[model samples]
Structures are given as structure tokens and as C-alpha cells.
Target chain A: MPSPRYTRDIPARYRLDAARCSACGHVALPRRTICSGCRSQDMEPVRLTRRGTVVTSTVIHVPPDEFTTEAPYAMAIIETPEGARLMAQVVDCQAEEVVPGMELSLEFRRIRREGHGGILCYGHKGVPVRRHEA
Target chain B: MRDVAIVGAGMTRFGELWDASLRDLFVEAALAGLGSAGADRVDSIYVGNMAAGQFVGQEHLGPLMADHLGMHGVPAVRIESACASGGAALRMGFLDIASGQSDLVLVAGVEKMTDGADVTNVLATASDQETEVYHGITFPGLYAMIARLRMERGTTTEEDLHWIAVKNHRHGAMNPKAQFRREISVDDVARSTMVAEPLRMLHCSPVSDGAAAVLLAPLDQARRYTDRPVRIAGSGMATSTIALADRPDPADLDVVRLSAERAYAMAGMSPERVQLAEVHDCFTVAEVCCLEALHLANGSEASQAARTGYSALGGRVPVNTSGGLKSKGHPVGATGVAQVIELFDQLRGEAGERQVPDAHVGLAQNMGGSGASSVVHILERV
Candidate 1:
């Protein structure tokens, strides 16, 4: 997997962000150019939390190419504390061990290699939050 | 805008067509529609396709299709909205006809995905590839999360999801053009290899290659071509955040609801009046979400409907009577238009054994990526 790296400065990354309405208290992802809820242009950027819980998950046995090597890997939609949700891989755990409501923390991991090391795309991956030993 | 009607419909047998190229699939379906309509000419053409550049390493579908279909120099445009491309194309066709700018128009959708290419990488183009696919979130994994959340909400069960697959497969067995013509039991879905945790192989639609086409004309002129013209009563479309995590309600699809509302308002009908529908069942849970979004049933009632056979043939409201994406196949661009074809047959009472009795009003809801985009159309038998 390509290592997880934030491409916020890059134009091609399609970074995940939200638009907070100044009037109607509405929030939207992708940092809308104008708030659809209140039609307010006074929106601001809010970086999503790096932690969340598994709302649901799936394992693809017959996987896709960038994901073929990780066939049967666990993937889930993690709802962050900021109320934003994104589909991501749930690693560092068995496929069966993952379940809804399991707390997860975002981590960097290799997703894929592009064009014989031309570009290495990286992003967030989730891992079950291991409880600290007493 | 003036009303539009589907003057004709056509599609190729959906499955793995190893012998056919993208152009072949497209030309075949377009020609079939032209032949069905008996129209010697078209004012404009619209083609719905998701990823021709990725699937077949080709793009610029408009000119290519127009040339191959022997309609070169005609105004041709391609619409892309992920899986809802076909529905979007149909809407564009509707606008062209409704505006009185065109008398006869052709709208076709085609996708050739069986070239044995790396589909995973290709499909990843649909989502936030960097944020989502980077961690290995396949399409199945994305939907599995929805299923798991639905389960946690006590709105549905694994068995309910299984029933959807089983029913669709049963219906697919009767569809001559279906990719998977064999029926599968609920056990098959439960026991099948897990693609995404709760979602199994059978619970998902196959990567298919096919084409579907339809001829659209003004409602007043529709009768000149075919006595069985299906009048398009209403059309609605909505778009949401491209990323699923951005949606406020993971279980709710406001886009479908909003689109349905707009369509129902235009059609002068309500969900309660729809007798049958062809919904985007790209995944089992998608059907459930569609049912809710359409307000055909309350939230989560889709699973109950599936389990009790209410969504099957001869049920409360037949859904996916054409086998849905699960059984019929999801050739991306072709799926939405194919759903309309099924409704066209049903409205004309020509759906054979799968026909819903006294089916006068029908609806087709086609969606793209994680409920981010949707188009709904209401069709009535004239």
C-alpha cells in the first residue's frame, strides 16, 4: 500500500474538507464555494479528526488492482468526532475482529505505487485503538 | 418544459462479451434503438458512460459513437455521473425534446468492462481515491459499511439483505438478457465469499459489459412512431457530496428523496401511486436505501419488504422486476436506461411473467457513487 501522506497543497488530491455556514449552522464537505444551506460565502475550513469509529465494514475477497494484494482486507466507513465520515481501510486487526462502534485511529499506510515509482499516493487508514496496559 | 416520451427502447444481452469491442456494444445498442423507432435520422444524441477511458482506454465517446453508428456530424454529447450516467443522459434527452429543439433524439448508454483489466483501480476513480481507496476501500467495502450501520440500527438483518439477492437472482433467471441467469438462494448469499464484511459475492452486482438505448420524442409526436409509447411524466435529479464521509446521515440518502420529490411534483403523482419501480441495486443495501429515499416505505422497511416478498413480483410494489443490478447486471452507463426499458415493458403490459398486474405508473431511480448523485423518472402508460 502507498504510504499515507497529506496532499493538501497539491491541486490533484481532492482533499476532504467541509464548509461551515455562518448563518444557518450548516456544514458541508469539500468546503463548498458557497454555503448551499444559508448561501453564505463566509465558510471556513475544518480539518477532520484523525480518529473515529467503524459505522460499518466490508471485506473484498475478489479485490481490485491497487487493492488486489490486500484481498480480503477490512474496509469501513469511519465517522469522525467532527461528524464527517469517509470510507477507509481498517488495518491492524483481523477482518472478523472489526465491527460497528469499534474505536479507530487514523494512521498513514501505503496504498499503491504509481508508474514504476512515479508517484506514491498516500492517505488515512484506520487501526483499532488498542487499550493501554494498566 | 413540454412532456417527453420514450418512443423506443433497445439493449444487448448483458454479460461478458469477450468477442465484442466497446464500439461494437455501443453501435449495436444504438442501431437497435434506431431500428425499433424506425427513425431514419436523429437531431442529437446523448451517451451515458462512466469510464470509457479507464475501461477501454478510450474517451471522446460523442464523436466516436456518432461516427460508428453512421450518424457522423450529428450533435453528440456524453454524460458522466458515475453509475447514474444513463439516467443523466435520459434527462438530457428529455430536456432536448421538451424544449422543442429536437423532434427525434437518441439516448444510449454503454460500458465494456470485461476486457480482463484491473477493475479495482478503474473503479477507484469513482471515489476520493486518495483518501478512501488509498487504504484499500473497494466499492464493496464502502457499501459493507452501510450494511453494517443499517444492521446496527436494527433496521435490517443479514437475512434481509440475503432475501434481496435471492429475489433478484430469481427474477434474473427469467431475464433473457441478464448476465447471471441462474437463480440463487438466500443461503448462497450468506455462504458466498465475503467481498465486504457483511456483503457477500451474491449481494453485489457483477462487473458487466452491455449497452441500452432509447428513442425519445415529444409526447404529442410519440404516437406516430409507436402506439405503446411510455410518456415520461416526471424527471428529477440531485447531487450531494462526492465523498460519502461528508454526508450527515450515513443511512439517509437525501439526494434520492429530493430527486423523487421533484419528479413526483412534475409527474403529478406520489410514491403511494407507483405500482412498480426499477431501483439501482448495485448492492443489496442500496435497494433498501432507495426504497426509503423514495418514501415508498418508511426508513428500514426495505429489508422487511425484501424478506416478506413485498418487493418481489406480485408483491406490494414490485422492485427490480428486471432483476436489478444484482441479477440483471450493472454495466454502469447502461443500467439506468435498462431500468427504464423494463418499466417501458411493464407499462405496456409486455413484461411477460415478471409483469406487475394493472401496473399503470412506474418509477426508475438510478444513483451514482455512495448515494452522492441520483436521477428519478416517472413513466406512465398512455
Candidate 2:
């Protein structure tokens, strides 16, 4: 998942845009052209729910060069209520604190910088839902 | 399809061979395999490589290696499936002989991983760039998530993972060609530096530079190359979505299961019948998952087999007797071909101390990128 020039999916990557299958109602993240669960080509655009729960999480100690400063950070696979899963870094929490079943809310954040003094790449990351509760 | 048999096997000592170029490694393994076969009737060549372009800034390895091996004018091609490139190439070579397209074929797997570059980034390119790897996750972090999920299920324990490293290192100690040819206890694994929490350095395969090669011939004429030949009874390969998140289940690898089923069906044998195996152990967690997917163990209980020493060498089913990709060193593309080399040595009774007694039928399962794709082959001594 190192930084690459994926300019096409900017909308989906930034806004958490997804494709909702017209036939089977299966939702795919990052806006799929066709439904993954169903063989249906008919799809509709939808904004994914920012709120989700951590399905799985890990503390990345030895990270990539782009994330050297963020070593020993928490990353997780957050599953939304609509049944779409996306990987996002867990901010506003300790690495060990982000465990399975923890409530989270997706927030737009700076993911990393690509190339030398390249463009500032921004995407969705998971923040503990407790901040919103307060 | 006609019967296909492997008449020769060879590979370079897997490690950080700083002096060896990608071409040097391939030629060493290819010539050793040809020497083992004792013939030069190879009509075609297939090279399995993952990322020659990224790792060593080289590409078009097919013609390059074929010409380097003195296999001039023969048809040459490259097969790639991330880490499973080596295994996938073997499957392609098997088909070449089975389809009667080539009388003899050379299949080789090679990778140059230690060029003083950031290999972690090069390997991560195999994962989903936009979705997963973009989240600042390395390869270890990906598998660590799998291990975390399995641990939450209470079916797999940290000790279960440690057992895999312990058993593989024990086997690796006897393998002179292995990268880590020294044994270590469970504590050694526990104390090793954590690359990703719950996945330590000892639990991960090392960055290596090496190559492996095998020669395939029709079963009817295999004896012309070597008195002993291993038959490629079955080969199966399957692919899933590239992103692990796209997969229906992170708890298990369905690609491995589906591919192994096709292989078992072709071979007409069950997992119990096989005397030994070399499942892809890219991570310690991967081996346990593969055991169940290969039907060597049942469900998540595969970790139980590891804990009980049932998967150890000379146990219920010896897995990774050549130390696997873990202790043996994973040069990525060369791994699949290297696995068959282990089976060749074991089945022919050439494996000295690590030989599984009376080993006959063996299975080698190679997977790519968090089990998105898998290639399974069943080989038997004939």
C-alpha cells in the first residue's frame, strides 16, 4: 500500500465513495465498476458510512520508508454497518488500544507524501468514535 | 494429457549472495538441474520471477536466462504470480510436457532481493496499492492482522506460531542449502525483534537472492535423464481478488483450499495418503492456514497440529522439511521451484538427515500476496 499515483480513484479514496449493487445489494468500497458479490453491472454511487468497528488491527513497527516517522502505529480493517471493509490507520489512540470490536469513525487525513517533495496524498483514516461521543 | 515427470532438480544456496547477479543465480541453478538430468534435450524454458525490474532494475528475464543457460533458440517465457511465480512456472512446464508441446522443458525460479534497497516496499507492491498498502502497512503487518484475527477466535495461539518456527529451524539445521541452517528453540522466536507485533523476525522469511530449477520430461522417457524420477501427478492454480480486504474471509484462505482441491482431485489421493509436504510458510501464520486449506489439518484446528508436533518432520505430516520459505530463505520467485527440489531430494532418498522415512507422495503449495492466489502441485516417486 505504498504511495503510488492512483489519480483516478481520488473521489472514492477521498470521500469513501462506493458502488451499491442494484441486484444483490452488495456494496463495494472504492467504487467498483461491477458488483463483487453479484454479477450485476448495474450499480449506483453511494457515500459509505464513516462509522464502523475494527474487524482486525495490527501495530506496524517496521513500516515503509514513507511511514518511518509513524513507526509503531496502529492500522486496522474497519467494517462499516453497510458491510464494506476498508483499511485505515487508527489515529487518536495508542497502538495496543485499537483492538477488535472497537468503535471507530473514518476521518479525512493526510496518508503520506509520495516522491521527493511530492504532492501531499490525503485519504480516510479511522479515529476512535469516543471523540464524537464527547 | 500425457504423464509428466521431473527428471532433474537443482538450486543455489539460498541467502544474500552479494556476488551473485540475477543472471548468475539463474545459470547456477539451471546448469545444476541440467547436470542432474544428464541431458540437454530441453526444447523450452520458463522462468518464474516476481520483480526483477524492481528488485534489481532488470526485466525480460525469460530470454535473458534461457540464453545464459545456453538454451539458445528454444522457446522461453516468464511466469509471475507474486511469491508464487516459481510454483506457477513449474505448473506451466508440467503442462508443456503433458500437452506434448515440448519433449523436455526447463522451469526455473529466481529473485535478487538484497540489492541494498528497501525490499519491504518492493514486496508490498504485490498487495493492493490504493486500498491496503496505502494505509502504511508492510507485508508483515498484513499477515499480522490475519494472525490477530485467528488469535481472537481462540483457535490459534502465539505458541502455535512459535512451534512452526521451531520445527522448521530444526529441519533447516539439517539442510546445508538453507539460509538459516541452525536450530533454535521456541524462546528464540519469542525474543526475536518484532517486525510486526505477534510476527517477529524469526517468524518471517528472510530477504534472499537465489534461484531454483527443474527439468521435466515425459514419463515414458524419464529414465533417459535419471534412473529416479518424480511424477507430477496433479497441478492446480487459482486466484482471488488482489486485495485481502476484498476476500470474503480473512480468517481463512479460500484460494488455497480451492486450488488444493483441484490438485487432490487430479491426483486421486487424499491428504492422509501423502507422506510429506512443503506448504508456503511466508509467515508462521500462513503455514497453519495453509495446512487446513491443503486439507492436511481440519479447520482452525491446524494450529493444534502444530502445537502437538503433528506437523513436524517425522510427525503426522512433515511440512517444510527443507525449512520452508522461512528458514530456507524466500527469494520470492525461486521459492516454488525450490519446494519441488525438496520433494525431489526427499522422495529420492537423497535428503540426508531431514528425510522423512519412506516418503513417497508429497505436496508443495505456494501462495502469493496474502493468499490472493495459490498454486498446488502433487508429486509422487515412481
Q: Which candidate gets the maximum DockQ versus the true structure?
A: 2
- The first chain of model 2 has a TM-score of 0.90
Native contacts retained, all candidates in order: 0.78, 0.86
Model 2 lDDT tens row, B292-360: 889888865689766687888768888999999889999999999999999999999999988889888
Prediction 1 global C-alpha lDDT:
0.84
Q: Residue-wise lDDT of candidate 1 within B1-382, one digit each (tens)?
A: 7779998888999999898999999988888888888887799999999999989889999999999988898999999999999999999999999999999999999999989777766776787755566566677767777788888889889998999999998888889989998988877788898777788888889989999999999988998889889999999999986666666666777889999999999998978999999999999999998899898888656778877878989789989999999989999999989999999989999888787888899999999988889999999998
lDDT of each: 0.84, 0.90
Runs off by more than 4 Å, candidate 2 = A1-6, A131-134
Least accurate stretch of 10 residues (summed lDDT) in model 1 chain B? B129-138
**TM-score of chain A by itself in each prediction:** 0.75, 0.90
Q: Please give the C-alpha DockQ score of model 1.
A: 0.57
Candidate 1, residue B353: how far the Cα is off, in Å: 2.0
